[model samples]
Target chain A: MQGFALYPFDPPGDIAALRAELRAWLAVNQPQGDIVARANCWASFDADFSRALGAAGYVGMTLPTRYGGGDRHPLERYVVIEELLAAGAPVGAHWIADRQTGPLILRYGSEEQRQRYLPGIAKGELFACIGLSEPGAGSDLAAVRTTARETAEGWRINGQKIWTTGAHFSHIMLALVRTEDGSERNAGLSQLLIDLDTPGITIRPIIDMAGHHDFNEVFFDDVLVPHGALVGTRGQGWQQVTAELGLERSGPERYLSSHALLAALIDAAGADPDPAVAALIGELTAELWTLRQLSMSTAAKLAAGEDPMVEASVVKELGNAFEQDMPRRVQAIVTSGWDDADDLARLLRALLIASPSFSLRGGTREVIRGIIARGLGLR
Target chain B: MSAAREMLCDTARAVFAEAATVGMAPIDNAGFGLLLVPEEQGGFGGDWGDVNAVLQISGVLVPGLPVAALIANASLQPAAAVSLMAGAMGHSLALSIEHVNTRQQFGRPLGKFQAVQQSLAVMACEVRAVEAAAAVLAARLDAVGLDPLAADFEIAAAKLRANRAVGVVTSVAHQVHGAIGFTREYDLSRVTIPLMRWRGEHGNDAYWAQILGRQVAGFGGRGLWEALTAR
Candidate 1:
């Protein structure tokens, strides 16, 4: 409907059918009010709304049913994520849980861990966060200085994690720490499932530029954990963490962050879009389609059980560039002040405020270029 | 265009895997370059996609194979390269260099001095131009069937850029490599050797300028750029 776009291939889902189903679901299950609006959607610390997602079985649709999932295709999960993001749904709370940690657990968790955790995760009864980044060690994950020493009971984790989104309100954090006594730096890293509510663990919110507590600094001070807390085999955490990063970095979420903003901006432009505005839309739309196909190709590859880290990096890097570029272009097209707050306008305000972190969040642009260079044979 | 491109890329990927050989040889050897022409065109069906893929895959063997005459022809497709494609070895790619070889005001290897940085930048510009143009054109080729002559212009531009500048980049590479380069055993020539050969084999900027000029004239002043860039 936007333009004569060459989507090129049949969209994976029957787009209309699924969109109609979701619209009906939303109409029946709208959130309580403006406070539970898109700004903080699922992440408004809204217990009731999260429970609603659980009841609707909207969480973790791709994992096995034994773990409270629909066991559907990854593309189905993609459809859900894209729809939520596009509608400006408050997915911030369970976003990390559903996106990265839940899948990592499913693939690498101990049987007991899977049975104890994933079902609640799929039900939205539980939330998860990641602790891969540290104050001194940001993009260089292997440089994580978190140290975990074995105690009489389990391992005691003693380190701090920065950029731990949703940690102040999260239930658990799957953290990577140096585990082995004297091994290769990468070899010593291992993932531990730490309870956020446990004593000696502190989570203090870091107000980002938008003044939201969406991100936090979490400190682990001799935190007690049982041996069952380890997510996977010891000494293999680097490889496991690498695999998890691939999952985290890839996905439609990488590209759809600005879809809501684009929609609002385009709608605001009205029926008589001038040639300049239309051209911007055309170019942006074409690039976005390329990203969608590349993302879908990665999903297909994953569904076929291949690790698509390199391809996923390429998609995320290119997609994030497009995402970051959208707001600047939108600002130029609209005459209104950017800080205006009329529902969709508020979403654009939030997106403009949040756009900088998009490139820095999963990985920096420099790191991504390094990856592409390696894949392109330049490195 | 998309269908044509997909088929060509898929087939080229398959052919390279089928025909390529031991480390460092496929690039420098004539046996492989001969495949650039279509097997029917007295040459192999080696297209730009194959060259791009080869450039990408070339890194799977770090520092990559030497670019030699045939590898150059494989990508640029000059008549001499076409001749080589027809099983003639054609003219060797050896360059007649006239590097000052002496230190100047800086008392350093003239090649090592900052004065030559422009030359290095120019060479780099050439490589950069080719890579960017190739990617941009590839994205477009998926949409329409342009005349091969249209692609011929693009390839000529890229080859000119590559040939003109590669000498600078590769020559400095040898200067940096030092006596080891002169030893002839070091693979330093792995990069420079192909730069020299490809430059001469493609008929260089002089030959391409004339051809491109003639082609543009025949287009009645509507050159490839004008056609391609038209909204």
Candidate 2:
């Protein structure tokens, strides 16, 4: 809560060449599909694009080379991530795996777990989904009732997880389940990496307001997996999950999700835009630039082995507001019908529906603000 | 911050504390104007980073003084104003947090209330954003060898961002402080009023927005990313 001094984002090697190489590769490999898909492109799933990008050594850039990663710097990975998000790349497929799970596994997973997951994750062929939110746990994640009991055969799990993004398509789920019987809130929780195809497990699609099946309601009824499925130390799931959230909250994705809309608006406005459009563009650019600086500094702090929980929360809050407000502000200023099929119109319509979930996802607005308040030593 | 910059800030804080009551005489005598002067010129030979740090202290202690004007040129005034605004807004947030944690209502400290905590959180976010802008702008200015034209994009972005944040930062500070913050005798206005004035001083929202908008428009849509990353 002291002065928010920015940590310098000094990545190793030739960063300019890195960006250039990636841009060139993307120019050839990126799917030139509908422009609307590029708006919140990170959530736009394209397995092919992800695989190709991973083949180019972009995925899991921070992991060790032995794990099929490029062994690049975290800031280097950050640069690649920002470029991908800014370009509106369809990075949804491996987003979770590369972002948090891969690193988490590398950090907390046993050698066998890392050997099993990291290579596939680094290959971008294996997909992972978060299993934090349950029917009883949304904002109050500690209310997670999912239970995993150790048996003679294995660990048997029984519960339901709602709002599990990518679970329907994921190969595995790193879940927070109650492992210690009679355990209370957040006390007996442990993280278990469950293979989604385990017996008695089921995944049902939860179509969003936008009519997209990005999330699912996953049920685990007597689902049993090997004892090795446990990740990190038992009963440290709460700490591990909170650490993972620090990675999830503050990233280029928070702000750049709706970047395509801003780009579309600017492109549609032409070189000599009207004063109003110009003002709006200027305003958005200023906020975007500022958010980028904040996000990068947070990433730098994280890379420097410092816990920037407060700074990360600040980024998520501001970045979410900037992104959520972009569409509404554009809709108010621009004269575009909701049903219009043009790039700008369609993007506006899509994002207007998608914007509400910006603050809702990763962490809700209130929850994030509370974290900031606590960081201020208020609680 | 580097050791030199830390020492520089130490000097700034002490001098600015004295200059708080004596006006700019102490600042003038202390040679803050020579901060950006080259070492060969018999001055303190510092970068924009040093200026940013010193001006931030000036903002917190002597917001009414023309410390920014003395250190940097008119071209850099907008960037300097951002540092000042960042410093002032941070102080305002610190004041709000202090007020809420100390002031009591309904038999409890205001900070214990969720509503008050949420407001301060929002205020803290704005303050942090401005601080990041000021720091990045200083980095850009130093990277470009203090050339205003080379750092034009950062200058406009930082100033406009700071300008836009003034409303939230000032309002939240006052709201959380209740009536005590509004009094002239209170120290909140020392930073809040100066923040209100500095917002329109360098480049107001519309002014920087228009200039930045036109500049970005010229960069084109896809070109904007290229230009941003290139810098």
Candidate 3:
């Protein structure tokens, strides 16, 4: 096993050029409006914005050019997303498909599947959501009760997936279900690329406490799917999903979720803010830089085709903690009371409300700790 | 790892293991002092990453020895060896984990307890943070030779994080070990004491945090983010 040595964050010249290009494009195309509107970050949905991003060749950056992508490295994609998140661009509509689904399809999808989905995904015309978490199976996905039975024509699916982000707006779902019954929790599971338009599939929005309709409870009631929809081999859903998480947990989104809020806080704290407040900002900034380095290292590993599951988990665990802690720390620093009308106060309010989901989304705090413990051979 | 670095790490590990049992005096003969000196400068022209790797391994193998400090004094500045100190702190953490895994209480290993697990988990995270900070600093030092002013914030941040980590790690490691860790008979003090001492050597968390605070304040609110992501 290779030890966790220090990897340089020096991007190639082309990657730097790509960053410049992306910044130029974002300057011209990104929505210009209230700072609070950008607070949603990855959760903010705008189809036209996503299409414009795709048109600029920023969406499917890492996929092969043969499939309408930029044929760039994952590090290039990292640079693009870093800029996007830093600018608080609304990328929610194409975020999942661009980030994970496109690459996943290219890797595991058959020629037919890839030809059918990858181009649309690359074009940013298709959106995707994961179907791993069921009603009782969030972190413990092996307990998934969703079943997909093989039929002569295809496969029939039945089960409910809870907290499925963007499922209502998605074109497809890479559903994980039990294709065979067995004693082993992970043995019989399989991944199915289910079309959201398939018969008997219903996606009902679950309004969050903040009144955001991003989360949905997707019901699969005898939904029919073709045999080709099965991704990879049968009984390999666990492995596939675990592999997918390396991509999921290793992105800038993990730590940059509340970056807009941090930027807002800094902007609000003018040049001559309180010394104590400045110190707090410095500490947070240092931590953010540290986390970004860790994250970029994981991206480097991914580019080298390494799983880095444990390292990715580390990034998510720490990144989530930092993001969730941002609002409270900001609240503590900005001692001068600002009314709700103040943008800084409004951003802080939004973050405080949404910050609780930071850890809960990618993986819960307990689950992440458990993963870290297992990685350390403690369990 | 380069062939030279691999050989150096293996040799250091073996020497540190022997030194751990015999005494700290053998560390001078371990060839760590000559690690960072350029070949042209009558020393091994080793990479900073390779040197830091040895430092971390040395930390784990023989935490009591001031071998890393000696290497730091020989290669970089007295205050610049925080990365090596971080490696030493990691060794202390590794020692604690080993102790907790083997130390049984009430017919079970102490690691089986949730409280112990949580403490160790937190320790592991701190260890990771220190490692990350140190790695970033090492990379920066390697890319551009250690100009103290250019790398001031990074060096300070690494030291501060490592210093803070040592406090948490030692507290938890000692907590997990109970009274034995505090005694001289047990080897845990070898690492814990040095961690406590080394944290105060370059700059303690409070000291560096104040510097970093002033630096950030100087950058103002908007300039702070730019300062952080400058690299």
Candidate 4:
């Protein structure tokens, strides 16, 4: 919190041209879907579109060329993802694998794991889900009761992971499980790269309030994975997961997930809007600009190999509030019918229902604020 | 920050410390008015980055002074005020953190309480956001050679964002300090009062909002994204 400096978001090798190329590609290739799908496009799954994006060398931009990746700079990857999100691309199919699992594996996974998973992930063919929250551990991630026992044959796992996003569609699960016999809390936990196709694995859909099957309840009934499934150190899952979250919490996705609504609102307002509408647009723009600065700086810090956990949390906290507030504020100012068919009305309706989950997902608002408080040395 | 800016900040801190007591005489004598003037013309050849850093210090040490007026022209005041507000809000957050960490309540430091922690976290986010806004605004100004019209979007956005942060930073800073922060003798008032004043000084919330909103509207929906990325 001291000497807050804006880390320069200087991506290498012709960023403007890169943006133009991506925009041109998206113009020709991005799927024409339901207008509402554009609001939270990350959650809009389209396997073909993802494959096309990967073919265009957009996915897995940061991984090494040895693993079938482009070997681009992390900031370059940041630019591509932000552009994808802002354009409302249906990136849901391979989002998790591309965002964290690919990088995490390249950083910590074994050679065999990288050889097996990295190529598929880079090709947008292998999807992944995080196995963190359970029925007993929502915000208290350390209260995980999931267990995986090492044996002469393999690691035997038996657990239930609730609220697991993309589990139904994912090819793998990066699971955090208790490994030590009597360990409690965050100790002795390990991350395992479990293939979701294993026997005794079940992924049941859990429909969200928006009527979208974005998350699921995954059950592991004596599922056995090879000993090679272990990622990083044996007992360092908490630290690894904490580092992974720094990647998760800060990104353009935090703010631009609902960018379509703002775009639609602006378009609907026309050139000379009413004073109230104009003022609302102005405030939202200011917030969006400030958030871009914060998010990019956090991304820059992370790219420089610095741990930006607190700054990441600050971006998450503020980005969540902005995205969450956009709809309610629009509702307050605009006089649109609930069941209207116009694009603005439809977007407003969709975002009003979707905004609550903005703060709740990734991390709850309270949890994020607590992290910031700790960063401020208040706790 | 560059080494040159660090040195500039050091000079600013020393001059502002003196100017805090006597008037703007020390700031004038130190030649801060010539900060943005070209070095070939016998001036510092400073950029907006220099002004931003110097004003932040001016905000923390001498918020009552007209340092921004001396350094920048009338048009750039909004941007200048944003840096000042960022500095003042950061100081308020720092002071509040110190007070809560030291002040005991319920047989424990106030900072230990989740309620106080949450409030301060919110305040900290506002402070950090303003700091980021001011920094980016400075970069944009420097990139465009300090032309106000060229950097209009950044100016309005940064000023509006800083203005909006004023209420939250000042309120939460005082809330965490209890009645002690309300006193004239306490240092909290120095920053909080000026933060409140600066919010309304250079394009308040509504002022910048309408201006930015209309500009964004002119960009249309898709054009807004193009403009933002292009800049």
lDDT of 4 by residue, A1-379 (tens): 5758889999899999999999999999998878888888888899898898888899898999999999999999988998898888899999999999999999999999999999999998889999999999999999999999999989999989999889988999999999999999999999999999999998899999989899999999999999999999998999999989988999899998779999999999999999999999999999999999899999999999999999999999999899889999998999899999999899889999988899988989899999988888887
Model 1 chain B: weakest 10-residue lDDT segment is B87-96
Q: In order, what DockQ does each candidate have?
A: 0.03, 0.88, 0.44, 0.91
Of the pair 2 and 3, which is ahead by DockQ? 2
CAPRI band of model 1? incorrect
Q: Candidate 4: misplaced stretches above 4 Å?
A: none
TM-score of each: 0.63, 0.99, 0.92, 0.99
Error of 2 at B98 (Å): 0.9
| Residue B219 shift from truth in candidate 3, angstroms | 4.6
Residue runs of model 1 more than 4 Å from their true location after superposition: A1-16, A32-47, A182-184, A343-345, B1-231
Give per-residue CA lDDT, model 1, range B53-156, as digits (tens). 44433322222234334454434345222211111101011110123233333655544443343333223322333333344333333233333454664544
User: Chain B TM-score for each model?
Assistant: 0.50, 0.98, 0.85, 0.98
The lowest-lDDT stretch of 10 consecutive residues in candidate 3 chain B is: B72-81
Best by DockQ: 4
- The stretch of ten residues in a row with the least summed lDDT in candidate 4 chain B is B195-204
TM-score of 4: 0.99
Q: Give me the displacement of residue B114 in model 2, in angstroms.
A: 0.4
DockQ score for model 1: 0.03
